[model samples]
Target: MTVRVGLTGGIASGKSSVSSILAELGAVVIDADALAREVVAKGTPGLDAVVAEFGDDVLGPDGELDRPAMGALVFADPGARRRLEAIIHPLVHRRSAELEAEAAPDAVVVHDIPLLAEVGRAGSFDAVVVVDAPVEVQVDRMERERGWSRAEAEARIAAQASRADRLALATYVVDNTGTLDDLRRRVTEVHAELAARA
Candidate 1:
């Protein structure tokens, strides 16, 4: 049997680190963020749909999707954000399914979905691993890593599902408030449990 794990966390919560560790442990990792990008990349039907919906201005000079420009628009407007999700989500789902189908029968397939809770997909997986950190740690990490101002970081955090909501959905919670070594240990423990189920 396959063990499907949905891994999620807030911005800067180190979910990617846990996902990387899971990959190293032989889990078949399917990254939603990567599929999101691939779907809307330069010469695709996804890009065509986006341009048709939002216009050509969403494209950068090099004919690629202007992510910053798109982010600003979607972040500020709920309707625009939903419209964008409507375009991207289905495509990502289709691609993700294709990847998942390619995994071995007994694989522990980890789907690293940043908005798993926000998108109401927590129950779809056999297990959900939530990588968590305090709000302050998240804010600081976003500031240092993404170069976002305090206000910008907070705004992005506010845009996602609340920390409480995400934790409520977790079968395993990796508290990522410490060093990389600590995160690795926690993730490895979780991976072992998931792999056993597989």
Candidate 2:
């Protein structure tokens, strides 16, 4: 059977790194963020819907979605964010399900969803893996690694469910509070366990 692993975490929590390790170990990694962008590309139905609702202000001069402008509008207004999610979430869900169905028997398909906690899709998977760190560490990593301001980082964090909530849904937890090597070790361990299970 295909093992659908929902991998999630807060911003800057190293989910991508861990997802990469899982991919190296033969897991088919489906990244929701990448799909989110794809579904809204210039000619997609999702983008048409977004343009119909949000107007042309969200479009860049090149006719592509202005992601930063869209992000600002959503984060500043909950209703707008929900509207955006309404347009994008279904597309992500459909594509992810398709990928899951295509995976081999005994395949470990890892879905890296950044907002898995907020989106409430953790239970859709065979296993939920949460990558986490202390609040201070998360903020620091966001600011230093992502160049987000402290307030911006905090706002993003606040928009999602708390770390405790994420852990409550997790079947496995990877604490990313240290060096990359430490994170790699954890990923390797999880990979081995997943391989054995397969």
Candidate 3:
């Protein structure tokens, strides 16, 4: 009877911020990004597969995955990106499922998945909550808050599934174009709705 809610948003759209608020309201937040990192940590099976496919150069001097170096290799190469996803996606999903199973039956479990739209996982959740903001707002946040150059911000935003597509899958949409207080209010409202549903 747990409510498996998928929470997603575009880059810098305050998705993680909303997820934090949801967690504060007693939802069990299982982060896909965090799980992805864990499954590929220095000695995991995931890292072994990555090393076999991308070579040892992708590893840092301390033997951890050199994330920047790996990003450089895969970001520009579609085949390389697919290979990496092939290795990591299943591992991430399996770990997420295990975590979800540990939640209380009546818990409102929120899975923070950045690529929910692109990965076609919306239907797997009881409800999809989209933390949305105008693309221009996201671009500004990237530049001012994250110190990204305009070009870099635009490129990163373009890399994700489109905002339209993300919203299309949203059972609840929290627009995050304003202040932190405004965003939190929206998240609290959504959390209440989710809790009731659970």
Models, CA RMSD each: 0.7, 1.1, 0.8
The residue-level lDDT of candidate 2 at 37 comes to 98
TM-score, structure 1 vs. true: 0.98
The TM-scores, one per candidate, come to 0.98, 0.96, 0.98
Question: Candidate 3: TM-score?
Answer: 0.98
Write one digit per residue (lDDT tens) for candidate 3, span 86-161.
9999999999999999999999999999999999989999999999999999999999998999999999898899
Q: What would the C-alpha RMSD of candidate 2 be, to one decimal place? A: 1.1
Q: Is candidate 2 or candidate 3 better by lDDT?
A: 3
| Candidate 1, pairs of clashing residues | none
TM-score rank, highest first? 1, 3, 2
78-128, model 1: which lDDT tens digit per residue?
999999999999999999999999999999999999999989989899999
Q: What overall lDDT, based on C-alpha atoms, would model 1 receive against the true structure?
A: 0.96
- lDDT agreement with native, every candidate: 0.96, 0.89, 0.93
List the candidates ranked by lDDT, beginning with the highest.
1, 3, 2
Candidate 1 stretches with Cα past 4 Å from truth are: none
Query: Candidate 3 — which residues are off by over 4 angstroms?
Result: none
- The runs of at least 3 residues in candidate 2 whose Cα sits more than 4 Å from the true structure, single-residue gaps closed, are none
Best by lDDT: 1
Native-referenced Cα lDDT, model 3: 0.93
